[model samples]
Target chain A: MMSFSLIVGFFLLWEILCIALNVSDLILPRPSEIIVTLVTRFPVLWPHILQTLYSTLTGFVLGVIIGVSIGVLIGTSRVAYGVAYPLLVGFSSIPKVAVVPIFVLWFGSGTTPAILTAMVICVFPIVVNIATGLATTEPDLEDVLKTLGASKREILWNVGLPRTMPYFFASLKVAITLSFVGAVLSETVASNRGIGNVMMTASSNFQVSLVFAGLIVLALMGVALYAFFSFLESRVTGWATRGNDIAIT
Target chain B: MSMTSDISAPARPTAALQPATQPASRSNPVHPRPAIELQDASVVFGSGDKVVTALSPTTLRMARGDFLALVGPSGCGKSTILRLASNLIQPSSGIVLLGGREPAAKELRIGMAFQNPTMLPWLTIEKNVMLPLKIVEPFKRTFQQDKKGAYRDRVHALLAQVGLQDFAGHFPWQLSGGMLQRANLCRALIHDPDLLLLDEPFGALDQFTREELWQILQDLYLDRKPTVLLVTHDLREAGFLARRICVMSARPGRIISDKAVTMPQPRDIGVIYTPAFVEMTQGLRELIAQIRK
Candidate 1:
């Protein structure tokens, strides 16, 4: 309730500042104008919003699957970690925007390139988080399992996988937003659909209110997915983080 | 000293009478074998210039069902004995055997508990106790096929032994440290291993909690009778629980003394104040003090 009111107050202040400065619509549209554009352009904007959502969702899911697999593999084996970690770091360091052109050339300016870009951009964090989770198994706990004659595979399945869940869920919250950024970046550069493309077309035509409208829609989608994953994290991995609650109380 | 013995005199007569009937049980052809044997086994960590000897050709043996404690000052390589016995680390020299032979992969049957409870936080207490059954087999192979819920019953029974029957559905995080430690004990013993290894399993608990766990552990040991090897620095704890106490020297640790504890079974907390128990602790404490110097 408090956050909602604060956000409303901030937008009201922005509108007042715009009017007081006599800002032109071409330079900066009022929040009121953006809302009006959002409502009036809903029919035209809905398809673009749906397209971005579809591409981002597809890319995020694929990224999680591939990233978790690679993370587990690298986390469990020293040789694999040593061989793959540096390569992963170097690959992730390269700005994902730079790869948009290559993806567009290969996949030809559609949802495919957007999805591949999102997947590429979103996978690194999941892999890093899952790998860190697996790598940090308590040595005492490992000893307890080892003495029971558990094979490495058994330990990984029974203990390592469950241990990595909180980290995996945390990465989802971060990666979901990155997936949106990736999809939008690819769309603005090459795609003919999605909110990114709509924003690009609107800005070029000086429909600044529509551009702001697209950004609002993108942020709403990001927040919805972030809240969804946060809910899942609390429910599924509550035990891993319940210690913090005890400390706070 | 006579006054101390006078207080314990009544307990001894009954204890002496009870052992006479034990020979009949011993005469049975199913004689107990040595549970763990470390024959001149030495461990050295690292190699070349960085090499550090942890245990120096330590030879030790425990009769099946014996409760033995290893006590020494810090950095005395007491834990190396546990690591070697569990096959977690190979000894640099000599042989370490379990149940009269080199432990084969399938024959690896040992239960271990450590100072930290190490419970899987995601699992309920019942599930945590049942974890070993899913890994070590013959249970492992048939765990999925047990439609009768026999494994669940076994876990429940083990949890009941530790008085955690009511908390079986609770996750580890909800339980107190002492409760988690009890669950840790249940997890260790659920598979019915031939040997139980404890590395200061109650070290982290408070004095009162530690004493309470000592009784629980003693009851469980008496009930199951698995050969136990406990490594601890607490001499009083050693005297109270173990049938034999082995004192190790400083680094490159070797057994300096292995003394038999002749105190009878089902001993009480009151026994610690008895002159004989105090004498045993004093002797071991002196040995450790000398090694420290």
Candidate 2:
């Protein structure tokens, strides 16, 4: 599942080539040696992994709350939406990675800068999704409510917000994954700890095997976080699917 | 918007519009009424090149327990008239009154069935049917107190009447078009509105289902007798269900013919194949053709 055996197979092929060429172990340290190094260093790497996971999770949660709230506000009011939507679009188009140094300079390294970086890049999807869902409420249904003399507040609470949930949750899942990527990128530049810092140190010291392990952890973290959010998404949207009624005639 | 006029019936309460907007209220009919009235009202939407007159001014009165249908082609404004009567849009250049004098009463306990069925896709069928009562005050206040019993019983009863009893727990998508439309009908009528406006309620169903619903609708009308205004392009449906069908012309829609169907009560589907039924459908069809021209 980790694809380690495939790397082992490639190393075996490389080892055979090295033997034929009479290459030295010092020049191309045997794959077995790298494995020994990987095992020993993994213990050292554990704290770094924890640091990255903490920053990523915090960033994701903070970004999602702010994004979804703003999204709902923009989505509901036509006048506010018209005035502010273009600015949101412009902001979303900017490559957030380019602004990482600015955030680090302002927040001064560690989890704070990393979080600001992740949130900057990850909040747009929630806004766009919620706004679209709320904007397209069925006119017929609205008319029915109006004729019945329902207050605007009642219509919004009973209909508008309920209709927007599926889109909101979907964007949340995507945003969580993006937030993690943003955290890693931010850590690569400014963090003292975290997986990104270890990878940076390993590359500088030519510890390619340890660097490989760190990457594996990065991928695993992303997948695990994505899985976690997917489960949350399904649970949150269970009501939405049931409301759509796919069972009876 | 022009869309308003494009879909509503053009025949308005012209007689009322000609008189003062503050014209003396006509004496209430001696009979108890369903609570909807339009006095010489005309609705003109948009301006210049986009100008559309959905309904011409004409006095129209629908009493309680009356079952009426407006038969017209596309752009004839049948649905517009229903919207105006339901107070969805204000009538331009005329007065459209509801439930007599009280501004609050003027809103009328009105229900409407649209082609989309328009059920909130996220709510279950029972919840959708109970939707109107949740938001529309008096009912909203009453709904809070009767939380446990009122909605469930009423939703079940209405869906059962339309043969969706088992689907009370289902979502809108789980149901077929006919079933969804049936649910939508129940949703509109759930408030037990005194007046019901149906815009092509069965227009999207299969012929068999359409005919089947004719009886279901007839039964519903028989039971509740809400002052009903059905807007449709179907001549046979109008002939079968309505006590009176107002045939409307295209573009600037106006009532061209007011045909009364005196067919005996409880019009069973078998009566549809009768000679009298055939003649009536033909007559209505011809009236539409004349208007189309």
Candidate 3:
């Protein structure tokens, strides 16, 4: 309740500050004007919103699959970790925006470039988090399973994977937001679709409210997906953060 | 962490006691083999200057249905012995065998509990207790069918015996330390393993809670006679629970003294106060003190 009220107060403050300062729409559009643009342009904007959402989801899913596979390899094997970790670190440090044009050059401007960008941008965090989760598994737990005569595969399935849920979900929230950034970056660089493309066209035409409207849409999508992932994290890993109704043994 | 050791029990009415001898007949053909044997088995962690001898040239054996306790000061490799028997680590030298085969033999089923309750946090106490049934054989083969019928009932019965029947649906975190340890024992016994290895399972509990768990353990042992190898620090605990107690020295640990507990079976918690029991623990403590020097 407090956070909801604080957010409302923040927007109210922004609206008052803009109107009192008499800021030009081109210089800074009011939240009221942006909200009006969002409502008025909903019909024209729907397809672009769908386009960004589709590309981001596709890329995010692909990133997670590849990340988990590499993570298991790196987490379980010393050689793989030593070899891949440096390369991954270097790749992740590079500005993802710089890579978007190269993706466009290869894919020739459209959803493919946006998707490839999102996939590459989001993969690093998932890989790092999953590997950390797998590597930090309790040795005592492993010994318990080993004494049960459980096969390596069985131990990995029963213990290693479940133990990694918290780390996996944490990375998903981070990577989901990054996926949006990547998709939009690629759309702005080359594609003629998505909210990023809409913003670019609006700004060039000096449709400041439409540009602000695009930003609002992106912010809303980011918050919505982040909320979705938080819900998922709670459902899957509720045990990790269960209410302190009883003291731990 | 399979928390719960064999060392803490000092309870049970002597009336229900049975002789530790007279091996119960199992279904196996041919002569029965000792459940575990370590011949000159030694473990050295790391190599070169970093090499620390965890156990030095130790030979130990346990017959089927034997309840043996290994006791010593901290760093005495008592836990290493348990780990060796469980095949969690290979000895740096010599032989370790379970049922006359290598300790890692596929057919061998072992149950283990440590000093820390190692229940998977994601699973409810009931599911955690039933973990072995999903892995070990015969039961593993028909687990889905049996889980709903005989297997589920067995878990409930064990839970009821340990006074945890109502908490079956609860997670491990909902229980206290003592309660989780009871559930730990149920998990260890659920699959009817041939060997049950316990490493200081009660080492973390209060004196009162530890004694209460002793009775639960005593009942479990009398009902199901799996060969047990317990590693613990408390001599009274060692004396109370096992038919035999082996005391080891400090680091580079090796069993220096092996003594048989003469107290009759199903000893009550009062046994810890009896003259004979007190004398026995005193003697074991003195032996350990002498060897430490």
Candidate 4:
């Protein structure tokens, strides 16, 4: 439904601009011409889209796993939080997008650079969100466990992990979208193939609809990842869930 | 009830007598005797110019099924005593043998309910109560047997005892202070521990609710008869619930005075208005006052 609306919206704008000023085909291709190009170019673009999906998903999973572990570590331990938290905040503030070229230089073109870029870009929020969740554990629960002859493992497993889950799930959702963005950007700068590379090629050839198609694929991919995490949230939290409104953070 | 320590409990009196003196008798004719065998138990926080003795080298034996209350002023190490029992921190010197073992993970069948009644916000009241049974043993055997069925049955029974059978599905945040404290008792009792330690549990409750819980607790003790160490500032509660009230001094806390209050079973709230309850409350309050000085 969304893709149909987006297509219609793009066509209306494309047709209006093309007809009003009688614009040159090279400068702004007519909507019909763009559609024709999209059909003819689908076979070429499909593989690049797959490549980007692989890199983005790979990077996202890696980033979230590492981020959550670090977050839990820092959040639960005073020494770790003092050492790691400020550095994370500072590192997140730096323009991570600027490192796309550096990643390419180190890893050499194609998938590696794109995956590394996505992973780096995706980690900060997951760490911050998970850390906040772990730090915010109810003081009462901690005391109860301590007094009940519970070990550190028992407290972490029964109370700590379940308590911080909403945060972890929330951070994963954000990381999914950001990872795709990172993958596309890295593909644009360095990759031989990917949705980003396809979009760049489409724009150079004056295929506006094909560019829009690639953008549509990127949007759909992000949404699909979000939906996957949503399913996961329901599974993990069903035991202790209050209601349907599962606020991640 | 295996009598291991030979600390025999004086038999139930056929006719209630007016607070009989517990004849300084430590020796009881039983196999498994439980006496709080503390040789030189002490705790010193910091040192030198800032040296603080939270509890001095003192000795006292609280019998197995005794309702002992530690009453003192703020910062008087009343709470420190409860912590020492739970093995939250080891004493600087000496030991505390809970049923012949130094408070290991599973040796001492101990349960703690804090003042806040800190129920895990995530679990429902039923699930929270069932939690202790899942962790501690034999119940773990029951946990493995038809896990959900066993837990549900146990939870329901516990919730009923706390007058929270209808609210089993509710979260901790949804419950009021009175309900939470009731749930706290259910959680502590869920494991059926030999010892139940209370650290100013009702201190935060309003007077009415606190008194109501005291009555609820009196019945529980009469039924379960668990060895209870209750620390409280409210002399009325201490006087009403505890069989023996240990009045402690400020800082370097020690059992300065141990007074006994013998009241009948299932104590009614009407008893609080009676002259006997008032007199005992006043007497304990004076003892605390003298220690505070």
Candidate 5:
């Protein structure tokens, strides 16, 4: 309820400031104007919204799978970590937008470039977080399991993976957001679908309110995905935080 | 249940008694195979100029069901012996065997507990105790079928022995240090391993709590009869729990003295106050003190 009121107050303030300043619609559209445009353009914008959502979701899911796989590889083996870490760091440093054009060059625009961009951009955070989680598994705990004749695979399954949940979930939140950025960035540069493409066209046509509407939609989607991952994190890793209640008391 | 009553000593005295007459020795030719045999085992860490010998060449043996305590000052490699026995680390030199064979070659069931309870925070105490059954063989093959039946009963019985029966559903974080350590003991014993290794398992508890756990551990030992290797600094603890105590010298540690506790078996915490117990502990203390110098 508190967060709901805070959101309302923020929009109300934005609305009041636009009216009081008598700002031109082209310069900065009011929250009311953006909402009006979003509602009026709903029919025309619906396909674009669906396209962006589909691409982003596809990219996000693919990115997570690849990221977690690489993360586990680096986490469990010192040789893999040593060989892959520097290469991953170097790749992650390259501007993802620069890589989108190369993806476009290969995939020839449309949804493929956007999906590939999203997948590549979000993989780094997931890998780093997963490796860290695996590396941090308690040696004493491992030894207890080892002396029971637990094979390496058994130790990983019972202790290593469950212990990695908190770190994995934290990375998901960040990775999900980055996935959206990659998808939208790719769409604006190379595609004729998605919110990014729609916003680009609206801005060019001086349909400022429509562009503002697209921004709001993207923000809402980003928030929704982040909240989804946060829910999962709490469900799977509740043990990590629930212990604090006893400590505080 | 109240903690004291829950962990009260058993009514039967004979359960705790071993023959009391037969002392253990490396040269006990009558025994076909010692449960654990370290033939001149040594451990050295690092290399070149940074070299440090953690354990000097040492020979030791324990017959089946022997409870031996390794005691000395800090860094005397008492823990190294436990690690070697458990096969967590191989000796840098010499042979380390279980039942007269290399540890890896045998399907030896082993259980170990450290000073830190090290419970996985995610699991309830009951599930934490059952971890070994899910991984160790024979148990692992039938674990799914027996999880709700025989395995559950075994876990409950072990928990009841340590006064943690009521806290089986609780997570490790909800329990006190003493309670968690008791659960740790339960986890170690749940697999009914052939070997049990404990490293300062009660050293962190308060004096009263520590004494209470000693009795709890005593009860468990009497019931299971696994070969036990305990590493502790407290001589009284050694005297109360071990059939024999081995004292070692500092740094590149080697066994300087080995003495058997010939007192009557299955002794209670009260035995720590007896003249015989005091004399045995004092003798070990002086041996350690002399070696330290």
Candidate 6:
């Protein structure tokens, strides 16, 4: 309740400042004007929001699947970790925005480039987090399982995977935000549909309030997706964070 | 590393003379096989210039259903002995046999509990205790198909034995350290293993909790007489629990002494204060002191 009021307070202060200055709407729109644009331009904004959402979600899901698989492969074997880690680090270091042009050249301006960008951008963190989680299984715990004649596969399935849950979920929260960033960056560069394109078109047309509205919708979607994953993290891997008790019941 | 006394070479003559007095039942005609045996087994970690001999060639044997404790200073490779018996690590030299056969060839079931209490945090106490059943075979083959709740009933009964029945639904992190250790014990024993290996299983607990767990371990051992090998530094704990205690020398570790405790079974915690128990522990303490020096 306190946080919600503080956010509202900040917006109100901004609105008051905008009105008192009698700022040009083109230069900086009031919060009320942005809200009005959001309400009135809902139909115009809806399709772009959906396009961005579709690209982000599809890319995010695919990224996670491939990331987890590769992470496990590297995590389970020292040889694989040695072989792949440097390569992954190098790949992740290349600014993903630089790849957007290459993606645009290949797929042209549509959802494909945005999605491919999101997948390429978002996969690194998931892979690193999951691999670290698996690699860090306590030696004593491994000894305990090994003494029972548990095969490596069994140990991986029973202990390694469960131990990786907290890391995997943590990466999901990070990856979701990155996915949005990737989608938006690609859309701005080469795509014709998503909120990024909408914002770009609106700014060019001098519809500053509508551009702000596009940003607000994107922020709202990011927050909602982040919150959903956070909820899922607490639910599915609660044991990992059990003693922390930072989350409200 | 500084070289310690070659304890095994010096102690061999004494060890050979002593085994004759290790009770007739151990050599009884009907049951000739020792539960676990390490014959001249040595473990050397790494190779070339970095090579470190963890356990010197050591031979030891435990009779079926015997409770033996290996007590030594830290890094004396007492744990290596347990690991060798469990086949978790292969001996660099010589043979380690369980039930008079190579460990790999034998259908040996081993239950092990460690100092950390190593309960999987994700699993509820009940599920954690039931873990061995889901892994070790014959049980693994039928655990899911036994839809009659037999496995669950067994888990509940085991939890009840450890005074953790109420916490069966609780996650490991929700439980206190002592409670988690008790759950660890239940998990180790759940499969009804032929041999039980404990590596400082109660070393982490406070004095009161450790003593309480000693009683729990004693009762469990009495109820189901499984051959037990416990590795610990606590002489009093060794005196109170094991029928036989093997004291090892410092690293490049080898058994220096294997003394039998004649204090009798179902011995109470009060036994630690008795003259005989004190003598036993005192003997071990002096031996360790000499080795450390």
Order of all candidates by DockQ, from best down to worst? 5, 1, 3, 6, 2, 4
CAPRI quality of model 2: medium
* Model 1: how far residue A53 lies from native, Å: 0.8
- Name model 6 segments beyond 4 Å from true: A246-249, B1-31, B146-148
Candidate 5 structure quality by residue, lDDT tens digits, B1-293? 32343234443332222333333544556655888988999999899999999999999878888888899999999999999999999999999989888988754688999999999999999999999999887799999999999999989988987878899899889999999999999999898888899999998999989988888888789888988999999888888889887888998899877766766676766666655556667777887888889
Q: DockQ of candidate 2? A: 0.57
Candidate 6 lDDT, tens digit per residue, B1-293? 11122223211111211222454236656557888988899999998999999999999888888899999999999999998999889999999989888888745689999999999889898988988898887689998865239999999998998899899999988899999999999999999998999989999889888888898999999999999999999999988788788899999999988777766677666666655556667777988999999
lDDT per model vs. reference = 0.85, 0.76, 0.87, 0.78, 0.88, 0.87
Question: A11, model 6: CA deviation in Å?
Answer: 1.7
Please report, as a value between 0 and 1, the fraction of native contacts recovered by candidate 2.
0.81
lDDT of 3 by residue, B15-69 (tens): 3223333332242344266788788999999987998999999988677777898
Q: For candidate 4, lDDT tens digit of each residue in B1-293? A: 11122223233332221432443225444515453455578988888899788998767666777788888888888888888887777889988777667777456677888888878877888888888876777676667674578678877886777678899988887889999999999888888888899989898999878877887787778888788989898887876687777788877788777666677555555555566677777776777787667
- Regarding lDDT, does 1 or 5 come out ahead? 5
In candidate 2, what are the lDDT values of residues B204-273, reduced to their tens digit?
8999788877888888889887888899888878877887777778867777666556665676666556
Question: For all the predictions, what are the DockQ values?
Answer: 0.77, 0.57, 0.77, 0.44, 0.83, 0.70
DockQ of 6: 0.70
Query: Per-residue lDDT of B185-205 in model 1, one digit per residue for the tens?
Result: 998899998789999889888
Candidate 1 vs. true structure, TM-score: 0.92
lDDT score at residue A6, model 3, on the 0-100 scale: 91
Q: What is the C-alpha lDDT profile of model 3 across A60-103, one tens digit per residue?
A: 99999999999989988889999999999999999998898888
lDDT of 4 at A67: 92
Candidate 4 ranges with C-alpha deviation above 4 Å: A1-44, A82-95, A98-107, A227-249, B1-25, B31-39, B46-53, B291-293
- C-alpha RMSD of each candidate structure in angstroms: 4.2, 7.7, 4.7, 6.2, 3.6, 6.4
Give the alpha carbon lDDT tens digit for every residue of A164-233 in model 1.
8999998999999999999999999998999999999999999999999999999999989889988888
Residue A138, candidate 5: alpha-carbon lDDT: 95
Candidate with more favorable, higher lDDT: 1 or 2: 1
In model 3, where do residues sit more than 4 Å from their true spots? Answer: A244-249, B1-31
Candidate 6 chain B TM?
Answer: 0.91
**On a 0 to 100 scale, what is the lDDT of residue B127 in model 4?**
81
Compare the candidates by DockQ and give the number of the best one: 5
